[model samples]
Target chain A: MNVPLLQVRNLTHSFLEGEEKVHALRGVSFNANQGEITSIIGPSGCGKSTLMYLLGLLDQPDSGEIIINNNSISKLNEIQKTQLRNEKIGFIFQFHFLIKELSARENVALPAIKKGEDSEDALERADQILNQLGLSEKLDRFANKLSGGEQQRVAIARALINSPSLILADEPTGNLDTANSEIVFDLLQRLSREQNLAVLLVTHNNQLARRCDRFISMNDGLIVD
Target chain B: MTMSLIGIIFGISFFIVTQAQTSGFQTYFIRTILGTNGAIRISDRFQDMKGTVNKISKDGQFKFQFKSREDAEYIDGVDYPGKIRNALSEFPSINGISEVFECNAALQTKSRNYSVQAHGIRINDHMIASEIENQLMHGSIENFLSDEMGIFIGNRVAERLNLHVNDRVNIVGKKGNFQLRVSGIFETGVSEIDKKRIYISLATARSIEGKRFGGSVFQLSMFNPDNARSVASQIQQTLGHRTVSWQEREKVWLDVFKALRISSAITVSTILLLSGLGMFNVFAIMVIEKTRDVAILRSIGFEPKDISAIFLWQGMIVLIAGIVGGVLFGVIGTYLVSQIPLEIRGIFTTDSFVVNWDISHYIWAILIATIFVSIASWIPARRASKVEPAKIIRETI
Candidate 1:
């Protein structure tokens, strides 16, 4: 736990269309410690999501360095990148994009199944996580059949099924009502502390941001606070 | 993915069954023809030998010398007492006989210069002429046998010479010859025979060839159609002479059908290509549609190639199902087609029945189907592998 879970230094990302280059994030720097819920807050289109993408190893920064669990990720090949993502990081999105065809339990077990995990063991673990999220009764329900709040919870259960060291959530409660949002935020908070896992959530919800262990604010593609 | 797999099965079933039926028909056609015609024909090495001979030619066409004065007699109306009796004594179970006397005859045209065949035949033999009689466009065998100097001419010759029945035609041979009457005009269906063959009696043929007292050219027919080849071989072995079956004489037809096989493969491959494209398109669309879900999958520890493998597995299932269905349908359809009544409308000589089934067709269909479907799945599978979990997750967020 002495080493930082995610360390980003002087990261920059840009998008090119025809001849014009638009910068999405510039010199964005942060360190996320283990066993803490860290929140990144900014106005719409202020690169908070970009920062999360970079931290999640989804996109390659034009110029920067990233260290996750003491391993340099920027120099890793595609296969290595995929392995790191699969083993060490979990992501939750604003929209609960669960596969409509699979049941809640099956959806959660999908990652382990893809990783060549034993099907029966994956299923048992998926059930345990779903039960922890109070979704044991809904284990066999399809994603689309679940209510929005239940679907969000299933997504969270799926994220934790892999037991990743770092959970990167981009606006995890952005789509929920205030009550559902509070419920989701409280779950995130409890899971982060109980599991001793580092959690990075990008959101505009000030109330949820205020509850996090640390607050990082962004504006105009730069970290301001 | 399962639904698409089912569709592939349905489509391939249609293709395989139709192909099998066509293959069955082709095999049957060849076998029936070969069964009736024998597998090979061994004849005298002389290439100029044509038709049956009722009379002995003084031109020394035969290698053996005559032993009696009866071998040189000119009987105006007589069956081949020598070869027919000899062949009967040799192979008793031989059921039918046909004689073709090679002679030159002049049609009673304006110029009297047209080339004429005078293929002499016995009118009463039903079994020997059944195949040929069925091909007759006009007239009957009785019409020619009841009259003297009667003849059966091909339809084309009848048209070209403007000749009809009972027309007096002068036939002159190198030796003892006579004038004959054209009793009936027959169509052989074959263009060459229709243009040139002239049917006459064995008696007139003997006088024209001046071999009346000797023997006619030997063509042995058997009771069991399947035994034609064995009988021909036995005749060859016993007589130490050569014989020829229609199959050996008409092998060019076999060559034409052999060429058709290439076209058949090309046709099946083209269909497989279209089916593969359809499969790839479906996979590509599915991946795009489930982008966000795929992102969720990646976040949960599924690698990019694992995502691709899922679609690949789905494609393989589709192809296998389709091929199995297609083969089943093809076999059933081939059976149905074999039950169809084949109609032969004109005078021709062939075995009408064909029983065709071969293992090669099934093997080829399976091999080609698998290869085609795999190639089809390759492109879309690659595209699926390129999906970045981070991009997907970021987009959804």
Candidate 2:
């Protein structure tokens, strides 16, 4: 058996709201393998986004051990975490968070550029990714000028530019119409199967969650099933 | 950014123009002072005139001595004056030397008598070495030199005595009184010199002082007046006489000039600092406005230092543009100021304003401005780099 791409053991986190302590997660344990789409679905305030933040290395859990590619990340320094994030994980957000001033290709190329890739090569790779995502005609359009679906596709292209081993997307199609939503979910599923990438998606859409390879439902910050 | 750049331009251009103008004024003042007084002056007190003169022969070489009615002992003059002259003549820095015979006397007009300092000079040689001859107000130096008892009076002396060219005045010396004609009037622009000094011929001076006062001092002009201190020291060491350089003689004025230069530097530095603060505020506002963009950049794996560099590069570009534009504007403004026909009257009268086109001022202005801009930009850049991407993203969502 291949080693799991991600492993979280006994993760726990909480914060104080004025006079009351609110526990966001309580000793949650999870694991994800390569070439699999793990959909995390839950009701509001179920700590789904909280779990995603911890998994993405954007926050440190109060008590937990996170292992990515068999390297423990719980004790990693900020710089090491940043390096790991840059080299091993990619992220997509609900709002499409594209830099409005940049063109579609430039937006896609930003992550590769930040990773210290050559400008010419980064730009060429961005073009190839956009073309593969059926955005060849919109490569030169500014992020603000693109349609809702095109902008989401550009955001997806930016995430894929680094070619990371794991993709963590939080509501990647939450703002899209039904047709664009289907298209985006199909693209994520196909990319996971074809590229052998481990994908963890947080969503409230039951129809989309059912289509993922494995679905984990959460309630009161614990994985009930 | 535009406002910050404008501030830098104003600061730099103001510094450049003021430096040029101040330097021009200082140069003119120094040159005028040097023109009235030679670069160096060597003189002797001759306290023991009798003992000094007894050691020399009554030969043609040493011709005169300082005589007083009360002192029975007297010397003929400086023994072998030619030997001292010849010793100083060999110096390559010496441009020319003028023999100066000086005495304290009283001038009497019809109504009043006033104390005066009388200078007896070899007219042609003195004219070649000093600027007094060229500053004549009423008559020519040639005319002043032609008469046996002719005198050139300063403007203030002529005015106070109500005298003019061709008016005869009586000069009372220690030994005798001599009648002299005011052949010319000159203005040196120095109030002390113009009010009390009178120039006469060497022959007339000898007659009034009983033929015992030859040249009492030597005024030396140098090829480069700035080297006067070293040259004066050499002359003093060589001849054992007292020597004073122009810088030492006008130390008070030089001190004033130094103070003015220091104050100008302080003013320019303050202006540059204020411009830097203005730049800092502009960048700070830019960072604040782009908070979300910074968050996204951070999320995409751009290090904090890289984010800082981007903002710093923007500031540097603005600073460079400001410096270049300011230098060009300063040069043009200086040129315009130089063309204006403005006359200034102080210790001397300048016919027109002058501007010094010194390149060092330009370079120093640019260097100072750059340093200030870098400091200003770095502070805001560091703040921008510390922005938390997760917090901003969560808040915005």
Candidate 3:
């Protein structure tokens, strides 16, 4: 009977791909709550990642309402939406999009700094997250110097630096080996249960999706189960 | 970026240095004219009040004032000398005023005779009257003041008449022959003054000419020569006499300077325009290289305006550097130009050319160039801000 941390209702999206109207998402609806991890699994073009992007405020929904922390942000401007994203939402991508020139600490600290946190405080916060993520010695190491698994962990540390309530991760472990993938997945799971954070995971790994607290089955731009 | 910066520097320096030379030339000529002819000259030229400047160009049409003591045709004099002196004293800008009389004379040496202009002045108040003493190539002011019949001759006159200090010469004026001694010789670097102009005591000028030809007029100097026009206009309004400022005496020369400045400005602005274009091109390329970083930043909560600010700040760095470098280079270039000893001399006697180093020009250049560079930078910054993070994220997937 508890209120959900993120609310979505009737999301529909389409795009013009070479003059053909491709419906990426259609009448999709979902909810995520605090302290829970959910997975979205489907074939290659079933709009799993598209739903995650819409939830993250990275793209506009064609006609839908997205509510984060009880605030309906569908009418917010770009600046307001960005502020809301920085304050309440975090994202993890498949490619570990860390800036190569920045060290692990700087990359993690960037989002906190963007939210107008004091830099010394932001870096200190980054250090705390990085250390807990087992990157204590990699604070000063540039993104390129870290291994693929290490870089993914650094990306996770960056996502958690601002202490957002909801994390939308699209295949956070898709590029890792079984051991590294398990390590990264275990961290995400621990964050959800321990911090009471809502997580939406878009993945191709059915086994990993089955292991989450709950999972959604998507097919042909709609949730089938 | 470096090329654009360099272009900005070159344009500003070239404009300032080139304009400095022409500005200096005008200043130098004005100084010479004011030194010898006084800052303002007042003559009872006509009885009209308003059309003085326009009426001056029309010669022989003016009705003479004071008609010569009922026949004072040759006398062009200030009506009340004491009232004029008191009125001039009320003006703090007026430094000093002297009465002057000039007459034509034919001077005969043993070998040749040369026609000359004799300027007569009071021996005591010689402030503005004898300002060119520094140009004395031979003889001295003290020597010129030693005798009652002493004369100051120009260097070219001395050269032609073979006259030196203590030499005797015969002057044929309206009254006939009179004797005088050459006490000094000066070269003013002005051919007209050095060739035929001579100076003598006021008493001697009257005795030699039998008081027939020369008429007294007021020659006033000012504390600041730049205020000469305003002060002269005010005086003319009160006294109703024709007053001529040094600027008015040399309008044709100043017009030549105006032409030179316009040409220099046109040449230099082309360079600055090219720099602005180069800046646009440079930042456009920079945005391309930083597009991925922009996408990442955009996706992670940074506002579009914040991304634009990053690129604009980079452009501002180049703009500031260019302005400082340009001004410094211009000063050095102008100094180098001022160093070359001018081989030929005419109105200005100095060995080197003159340069005006007022700071206002530098400030003006900075302001104008800042607008140019900022707009150039904004185009690219706007492009950077509009980067589509969703499109890039889709591509990566």
Candidate 4:
């Protein structure tokens, strides 16, 4: 196989709940290759979200290694991790967590701005991406003013603004209706193929998983398939 | 945020008004004292010895006289007043100089007798000697000067003796008892000065105290009274006389002014501190409310420092707004307070509430507000920065 865009080896994570240590992830391994939309589907409490977080670098694995674009990032400091996330990885959560105070374009441009890109240029890029996602009219609208579908589209525009090699999305269409979900899933797949990007999707929608380039199933904190 | 701004406004306004009132009283008190004592005074003991010897030689042997002190005590006077004036004239700070003969004597009326301080000032330089000319409540300094036996008594002293302008009083000195008339009764609002001081002519003072009394001192007014100490030191170095500044002469009053300033500072600081605490609570709540947003930003690639900076900028914006509003309201409040005609009579008398438009105080108030707001914001910003994206995301999911 071609060198994967993102690779995770023996990822483990645990949480302490009322003095009981519950294993959220147990030595889970996964690879997401360029030009492919890889979907991870499982039932609730199956550690799919936990693995996605570890791969996204939002949470540190207890014992594992995450290599992105051929560079090991597991040993990187928090600042380096944030920089890598800014420059190389993108995230789309289920809730479309856009800052309510900012406009849709500003929300999209935030990651690029944080990466020290010129604000005007970042905003211009954000406007172009948002337009491509059919959100041109909502560019100046505040996040809270937009509908659920429009907000998720803005989140997708934000995830694509930095043009990261790997996009880690956790239930990006979870809060959307069937029409919006199909539209978003189609857009992600198209972007993955056209831009040669690795798209990792964590979801409970098996029908959507079956349409991806590759699919992995998880249960009891382990990859079952 | 509104509460914080209001607190800052009230604190700064109170501070500005208090400073203005206290400074007004101090300025009035100092001016009154300077009117009588001058900005700087050179004692007679440091007078030129050679000039005294020449006077003794020209006038023959003079009788030794002790006024208020013991018989063995000797009181010297300024023998070369012109020489001292000429020497001080070279200094740019020296505005004007006057000669004065001061002594202790008993003022006896028909009903009551009191020991009083007598200042015999040059009629030509009386305005330069003290502000007594402007302080005359009953009669003019010209009337006091034209009458050879005329004396300017304080209002309290006049009240004590039931004396009025043109009233004759017995002034008994070591040389002889002289009958003097009160030509002017002045009120400086200083208890010590109003109760005990009386001004007479230099020639009359000399006659009453005998030939032993030359000009007892050289009183000087400076262009900037605040520079009196340095100028006095310079005069001492150049003229070989012991010089005293107005501040040094009124040490007790200056101490009182210092206490007033300290108390005002404490009050203003406490107010600002409470304002800061109020801001801290508001920012803390904002941080808590914006936790999910903070996590979202972190997930979008913001570093911890960047997260902190966003919240800090928010706090700084609020602080700037509060500072601008506070300053405007403070100035307005001070102006309003000044417009109210309130006479303050304490150790001194202030005709009206005076507001000093000193720019430094306003700048200090702004600086204090900025520091307090910064501290208030930093705590919440730090806490906000430490929020974990994973924890928030998991909780929400």
Q: Pick the candidate with the highest DockQ.
A: 4
Per-prediction share of native contacts kept: 0.78, 0.40, 0.60, 0.80
Query: Scoring each candidate complex against the real one, what DockQ results?
Result: 0.41, 0.44, 0.67, 0.69
Where model 3 places Cα greater than 4 Å from the true spot, the runs are: A1-3, A15-23, A75-77, A144-147, A174-180, B48-87, B90-92, B123-126, B133-146, B159-167, B187-189, B206-214
Predicted candidate 4 versus true structure: per-residue lDDT over B1-397, tens digit per residue? 8888788777776776677666766777787788767899987444233333222334686645222212122236566777767887798888778888888888999887899998887766868666777788998877877788899998889989999998899998868788998889998777778888898887777777775545488888888899998888777656656678998888998999879977887888899899999989999999989999989988888988988898789878877777777777778877887787877554566666766777777777778888888999999999998998898988887
Give the lDDT of residue A147 in candidate 2: 87
User: On residues A1-225, what C-alpha lDDT tens digit does candidate 3 reach at each position?
Assistant: 445888888999888889899899998888888888899999998988888778888888999889887889877988899987887888899988899999999999999999999999999999999999999999999999999999999999988988899998999999999999999999999999888899998888889999998789999889899
- TM-score, per-candidate, Cα-based: 0.66, 0.76, 0.86, 0.81
DockQ of 3: 0.67
The deviation in Å at residue B270 for candidate 1 is 5.5
Candidate 1 runs further than 4 Å off: A1-3, A17-19, B1-22, B32-251, B255-277, B345-355, B392-397
TM-score of candidate 1's A chain against the true A chain: 0.96
Q: Candidate 3 lDDT, tens digit per residue, B75-171?
A: 2656666677788779899886877777789899889889999877764555554375776777777777788788888888898888998899988
Of 1 and 3, the candidate ahead on TM-score is: 3
The candidates, ranked best first by DockQ, are: 4, 3, 2, 1
lDDT for residue B386 in candidate 4, whole number 0-100: 93
Chain B: TM-scores of all predictions: 0.56, 0.75, 0.85, 0.80
- lDDT per model, in order? 0.69, 0.83, 0.83, 0.83
The ten-residue window of minimal lDDT in model 2 chain B covers B68-77
Q: What is candidate 2's lDDT per residue for B81-170, written digit by digit as tens?
A: 567679888999988787777777889999999888988888886775688767789988767767878899988999999999999999
Model 4 CAPRI quality: medium
lDDT tens per residue, model 1, B1-397: 4544555454455455555555554555544443322333333322222332445468956654322222233323224445443654556556565544556665556555567765555666422623455545666666676886777777788888777777776666656556667766765444566777777787777777777554344444555544555666566445434555544455576565566665666666566666767777788788788777666666566667777787778778887787777678767766776676665423232223233466666776677777767866766777777777666665555
